[model samples]
Target chain A: MTSIAVPPSAPEHTGSRLTRVLGAATAVSWVVWLTYGLVLSPADVVQSESVRLFYLHVPLALSAYLGFTVTLVGSILVLRKNSAFWDQMAGAGAEVGLVLAGLVLVTGALWGRPTWGTYWVWDPRITATTLLFLVYLGYLVVRRLDLDAEVRARRAAVFGIVAFINVPITRYSVQIWNSLHQEATLSLTDTEMDGSQLTSFALGAIAMALFTTWLIIHRFRVGWLEYELDRSGLESAILERRGERTATEVV
Target chain B: MIAAVAGDAARIVAKDLRIERATGVITTQILPFGIVMLLLFGFGVDPALQVRGGDRSVLAEVAPGLFWITVLLALLLVVGRAFAVESDDGSLDALLVAGVHPAAILGGKAVVVAAELVVLELVVGAGAVLMFDVTIGDPLHLVVVMVSTTVALAGAGTLFLAVVAGQRGRDTLGPLLVLPAMAPVLIGATAAAGDALYGAGSGGIAWTWALVAFALLYSVAGIVGAGALLEDV
Candidate 1:
């Protein structure tokens, strides 16, 4: 039997092994992070075990905020001066932000039940986050607009920059009105957690930061590949179209 | 010359009005639909009271929110329609470069949207009172508050529209962007309405000024934003 040719100097794995490797990595990190977050971290004397959820909620929410911030910078750059790099970065940031925001929604819902005796409340903060989520969702919807690719990119860039209004509102909503959601506990200079608890959280947050950055790198590569596919398809289509145009002209 | 200027502005306003009357947009549709929704809720489809553990009464405390949500939905549907007429004729670009002050452009459109809001609030309010049996403490103040708040909401919305009208994907993104910006107005208006329902006259007054501030902010922001971005459009 002919042997399957293996590429030299590259690691080889069957399809199943690849997934097993990923799952193993995920399980290891998940255990380490959750252990640090749940058991090792000291519970707030006031909030008790309920505060454990902060391990997920705060990191997820802050990551989401950072995503939008990155998206804003990218959008402004792209719109002010047309550049593919900015557009790609914006796409990357938005995709990551959407994931983090989704996590925030789920984690917040999980935390709400124990604290508020409900899964969701229409408090100003919750409503504002929901609204903010809708805006990111809006960006995805706008991305689907049927137009020239460049036109769509430019239009989406403008929309991204403008729609970031919700970012500030989502952050300040608790202060602006009565809301069930608590104020942020972590400031650059001040944090409410004890040292050990803070250490565990800092570790989990650092892990999340690593995961997010890695995910973005992968996502950007995927975006570049997809763009390449589309570009090749467009070229072939244009060639066919041009040939038709000449035939019609001659006729 | 003054007569001609007034005539020109008036003619432009009339054209918008005539076009609006001709094409019944999503706003006109959503208004009746919102009323019907309130009616449906009142017909005992769901408990509309804040007393049944989580009642959130259909026509009192939550009533103000329901009213504005209905207003917000209707405005969402209509605001995009404002630019449709000019865009269709390809005249929006020409209109921007015609040396007419952008204020006049936004002001004229604001008037139209304000009028629409008044008419819409009347219908939605009447439906709430009739179907859900809402109580009105001061009918006159309620009327004033509703009108003023509607003006505030529409002013912000239309101003945003003027700035973003010609851009790509604006039809969808306009509402998404504006609703967040309108939260302060919506919150203040709803709070004022709630206070009046509870016999707190002074809080109502306090919230009224909030509406005025929002309106003024919308006006200034909208005008300056439009002036800056007009060249791009």
Candidate 2:
């Protein structure tokens, strides 16, 4: 039988010094955002308390878009370079983006219940975002398919590019379709922000961006470890098979 | 280069059409499935139900959505079958080994799916008309929307079908991937077809343009991305 040596001081987690710093920064910004956004900023005249949700909702939406944008760039890089690192980055971007997009929908719905008098409407942005979420959901499913690593990455990269192109086209079509049917009764961007409100929003956006970056970096590391483990496992299995063959031959 | 690609694509399309002709799956199975879906929509919407605040029946008013949804569902089968044959016999791998450009494969498959969908749409459109008793307000608009939407659906569907070609549980995954990607097609086609059939003046021409844009966009994506997607399978 083949024996393997274990490292005495291997890191037990995906975290590193940069991630630790990012984690601390994200935590500090969130605390600051919570203090200012919840207490210091004034509410809207029309939307009143519901306007507070926009602090999280808008930033979350932006982060979601940014995450998917990372996926798009990573996917392009994968196709151009055919590197496993790029594939891992693409997958991490999509996983993080899908979570953020899901949160955006939930926050939007929770905010909508109070402001729009309905939990959901076929508003252009909302519809397009929902479809975008589903599109990435499909991407994730493709990523999970059982296949050879290179084949899987190639397939996923192509899908990521195609799905990213779909977002703007979806938004445009939904916009036109919405306009043809009825006038938009409420728009998400109609809020008028004062100085404190703007500061709070800006803070929240920065915090969310930092947090999203932290999550994606961690996720990418985790995916890299997983790929390494899979490769090592295959190597050991092959080694074990060779060892068994040698033992039987000696017998 | 373009000519070679076109030649390969033409040969593939011819081969697929020959297989389809021999099997009669589209006519015998898929076409009936679409018509039956139209019937099911009629039953589900209730034949006697009238539209709210309108003189038309509810089914008549919603016939466009139902019709497009049926076409979309049927398109799944068409696409699934298109690639299933290739994958089942390992012909996809053979083709790749034979050096058929992936773009040609994509183009050929998409064209065949679009052709099948057009035939399905015509039969299903007739079914909707007979079952719902709706009048065609603009034949030209209807034809344009149908053609463009069919092409868009085919392009997106073929690309996604390629994505899921040899994967497990692809039967379900195929729709999961294709439907959301093709949502814009459903919306644009439904709105445009409604205008064509009911003269609702709901920017049918503009919606037609949207469908055309979708068609062109996916066609380009499929042609460009298929090579990467189908590299090994």
Best by DockQ: 2
Best by TM-score: 2
TM-score of each: 0.70, 0.91
Angstrom error of the Cα, residue A65, model 2: value is: 0.9
Candidate 1 has an lDDT of 0.69
Tens digit of per-residue lDDT, candidate 2, span A114-158: 887787887767777888899999999999989888888989998
Q: Ten residues in a row with the worst lDDT in model 1 chain B? A: B50-59
> Per-residue lDDT for B100 in model 1?
59
State the local distance difference test value for candidate 2: 0.86
User: Which 10-residue span in candidate 2 chain B carries the lowest summed lDDT?
Assistant: B46-55
Clashing residue pairs in candidate 1 are B49-B55, B50-B55, B50-B56, B50-B57
Estimate how well candidate 1 is docked, as a DockQ score: 0.21
Sliding window of 10 residues with minimal summed lDDT for model 2 chain A: A178-187
